[model samples]
Target chain A: MDIHEYQAKELFTEAGIPVPPGEVATTADEAEDIARRLGGRVVVKAQVHAGGRGKAGGVKLADSPEAAREYASAILGMEIKELIVKKVLVTPVEDIVSEAYVGVLIDRANQAPLFMVSPEGGVDIEQVAETNPDAIRKQSVDPRYGLLPHQAYALADFLYDDPKLVRQATKIVGQLYDAFTKNSCSLAEINPLIVTPQGEVKAIDAKVSIDENAFYRLPRVEAYRDLDAEPESESRAREAELSYVKLDGNVGCCVNGAGLAMATMDLVKYYGGEPANFLDIGGSSNPDKVVAALQIITADPSVKAILFNIFGGITRCDDVANGIVEATRRIDIKTPIVIRLTGTNEAEALEILGEAGFSAHTSMDEVVQKAVQIAAQA
Target chain B: MSVFIDQSTRVVVQGITGRDGSFHTHQMVAYGTQVVAGVTPGKGGQTFEAGNGARIPVFNTVEAAVRETGANASAIYVPPPFAASAIMEAADAGVALIVGITEGVPVQDMMTASALVQDKGVRLLGPNCPGLISPGKSKVGIIPGEITIPGPVGVVSRSGTLTYEAVNQLTQAGIGQTTCVGIGGDPIIGTDFIDCLEAFAADGETEAVVIIGEIGGTDEQDAARWVKDNLNVPVVGFIAGQTAPPGRTMGHAGAIISGSEGTADEKIRTFKESGIAVAERPVDIRDLVKEGLGL
Candidate 1:
């Protein structure tokens, strides 16, 4: 789960990492007020769940409170990568002598948290990786031992040559590890780990993404979820035990598992049709869950055809068939519906669908082709 | 000659009194697996009426269950929050193979659990996977035994139902498997494709293998390298998520194509370069397997 830059700073501050004071403002006037309180010069950054904010013109440097208000007005409600800018972060501009990048993320191959420190900063990390891979130094921290003091000092050397600057960077590295592991963050980064002429190192830009699987223990952090960043159908689908992602297509897909769901969508595209959405009814599905999935799929206006491909294992096909039958009674769906169910209780499911005036196929290829054909005709 | 589970494998079902544990335990017994014991902390001394009239003993802890039943393998059905600890407990109790059936375990938890299990030299399969099944012999985890038949093909996958989809297609087409393993879809899974591939390579019965992969990480690429370097047997592969958008996780937490890496195109390219046939769709898996095995 991606949090706003300001929210990440809050976590950094909690971990005793030095960060410039920042305030989140919802209105242009509020941004101006925050700028005036912080100082005359401030940076107004659009607070949305996206990257390349500066390139997208969501970030602006203001020389005065009036300029801050103007920038905030222009940034707020502006769409960057299809997400509306609902809030702006106002912070005082700082003087910087050097810029470096420091980050920690879970490394799948190593099965541990990997700390990366780069001499260069504030530019695209991926770009730097492709261009000058030598600039980046990486160290994997054993989750059992954490970032050892020597490991932190070793990683800190990549960012600075001065003793004082290296010392401060080392401390920030330790604190960053704390913020990452303590918060159960999958990724935490500090771009432009700036150093002033005074030999002080601080995090100027913060980005932290929490692991949603840990939300069972971190309720307070779960409250940071930005509902506005997600679509209404997605939020509603979560409530109904479904995983959904909206797309620009005509065939709506509802399947049993994640891999099968993606495969279903891929097959739809391969058969010359675009999927309206990606929906997983999930394992252990019942009639009610199937009904909920159908309702959500039919709710999309771009969906010209609906397809259900369930290879039931833990899920019973008959249960899903009952749900589809139950959903047709509740929702007035005008789109064409296609279903292909095989596996446990297949005979019972086919009987249920046939009696309900629905034709169910056994072959995944045949069913996907039929749905694509129907959607093309529609 | 199966790789992991066979008729001789003694199984213990963790969280056996719980909803999922109880349901799948009966299924395992009904399939002729030797379900020797069950562990449900407070339900110690209670006996579970596993199908086939076998009264399996339930113990309070994995340690006690292991001691009493001499269980060589464990199937975890605990909830996500404590699932990592359950994996650790199974390893601590000296189980040779630990198959974690629970989904949604925190990656941080797995970081510690997976490392500890590795240090102990124990094999941990999935924290979010349907376990393995050696058809007509032994069934462990949640994979349905009825969809499988004992034969020459071995399967490893990153999905639950999708594995079933491919396996069912194979079984219906008169093809059978030596053992089908679901390595799971979590980013920090206990086992990877290479681990299962190595096991299948060692087994004499596994003539051909089917590898099912999706977007996320370069594990599939590494597995392709392993296949090219180590194994000589024919391998057929299928990668889902060709039409999936980048940065959006498709249900499985690990099934997302981030940046330029971990894309279906990249995985498919690696598979072809390694001399493995790539299936364009799930339904195409059976024919590719047939072509690889010279059937």
Candidate 2:
């Protein structure tokens, strides 16, 4: 649900937030043409869906259109954090006097939208929040009332020097809030929102995370979901309507719920094993979900063992066991499986699992240890 | 005595005409839930029943069902895209509690829905979970019909099967649950450890509460703080993100909490500091729950 910097800037512009005029180009020629069109010194930034592009040599300052093309050509297929630079954002570089950070998210405790503004910009705000909580000012805006002008002015006062700067900052905060609520964004951030030497504030970077549930309202954000960024296992799981997240480890975990998968992974680690993935087969323990989960887990070469931990409630334990048995029959599963089956028809599930050269465990530690040991040996 | 849904609770199923809707509805009804009405947009005026011919009338909207049947709680099985809208509709209709079982809903939708629902004093359970079930009474969700043999442990988990895994181990250890809630996996889910813990703490049937949380968010820490200050009920905590490599997200969309403070170590330490029994292993959860209960 994250979009590139250019796309975020486009969204910011649509919301009437001031941003330096910029153009995206995929090739050196396009970069030169765009730079020439802008008719001034430009900043060429590598377009990737990752932070630290500036630190990673993905950004360059060009005094001439030819230099912009050179920088663009060099960055055009370069890899930054595993994401290839598909495009470069060419913008008229601005002279900045100061920088700040602004973002908005839902505050669950207060059950209201919270806006965060910090004087420290272009760095990890989390570190600042942890180390110097006071540097970041947060205000929870009531949903019905929205973010008021005074609330915006208070945040602006923390960042701006001149009163005129406060007026511009207030407009930017208001626009950011509009973008956040209207686009169904879980996070909309403008880092290094630079105050020009001339005293006008402009957002130079945009990082947005759209809420997946609100895709119905914004097709543009939904279209930015890159399948390539997701693990193959997760993509397959999505197709099957199961939930899966790949981890960097050896034990393949198949549990019925998100919490259990987490507990399963945690236990696997506690027992000196690393979980290869987080797979939730959901409520219907249909043999198909089990089969699908097995397929996804086995497809990963790094997976050393498989763990089936089901606390069957609406999903019968026997059904999950049967599905595992069925999935084993359908695929060549060389990885050893350590299963812990509990709840609804567990006796029947144990009986079925026992026949398949495996006995269910009542102990999560025992199963995790076994799985981790087996995976280590493998 | 049970938290949320009990024997006398009247339940309604939203999107009951669909395949998943019909199947889980029948299962809950068979498990002894007082399922009084089913809602489907265009499939009203029909009747669906459990195997025993316990017929329930169908309505097209949540308001209609609420008016006709006086159902206070709703179990929603609508697809992901419509899930948020469905939850809002149920909340608007004045359902005291709503359990959303759909997955892959966008976070913004849930944020808006969560804001709207909370504003109306409606509590929502999950957007990608098996929902909540109070064993041997009127069950309201997708938890397996027969796995629960009611006891005193109140279970809350962010992962679906892990709750089952925890419940199963508890049950195998001859422990039964007062109520088990699967809070779902998505990052922007409706409920979290704090919400479920509050419910468990208030329930008279719950002698101890077993909380299952993952690594991604401050939910575990928030719950730990609440436990430290709140009721006398013994609370056991298990966090899932312990072994997960730092920076890897979970299956539940809400499973990842932004920032470095969201690590499993932080949550575990917080829970431990709050005087809650912290279990690093899933199998150990049952014992922790028992120890919390003074069993």
Superposed model 1: Cα runs more than 4 Å off: none
Task: Give the Cα error of residue B148 in candidate 1, in Å.
Answer: 0.8
In CAPRI terms, where does candidate 1 land? high
The number of the candidate with the highest lDDT is 1
Off by over 4 Å in 2: A130-133, A227-242, A284-295, A316-366, B127-129, B184-205, B245-248, B292-295
Candidate 2 lDDT by residue in tens digits, B1-295: 6787888788889988888899888888888888999999898899887668898999999999999999999999988889989999999999898999888776656767887887799889888877878888867878775557789888888776666667777877889988888887776677777777787777777888888887776777888999999958888877876655554456666666565657888888998899988776666787877777777
- Which candidate wins on TM-score? 1
Q: How well is each residue in A1-378 modelled by candidate 1, as lDDT tens digits? A: 888898899999999999999899999999999999998799999999889999999999999999999999999999999999999999989889989999999888899999988989998788889999999999999999999999999989878889888899899999999999999999999998998877789898999999999998889888888999988898889889788999999999999999899999999999999998999888866778888888888888888899999998889999899889998998888888999999989999999999999999999999999999999998
Task: List, residue by residue over B1-295, the lDDT tens digit for candidate 1.
Answer: 7888899999999999999999999999999999999999889999999777889999999999989989999999999998999999999999999999998999999999998999899999998899999999998998988899988999999998899999999999999999999999999998899999999999999999999999999999999999999998999999999889998888888888767879999999999999998999887899999988898
Clashing pairs in 1: none
| Ten residues in sequence with the least summed lDDT for candidate 1 chain A | A282-291
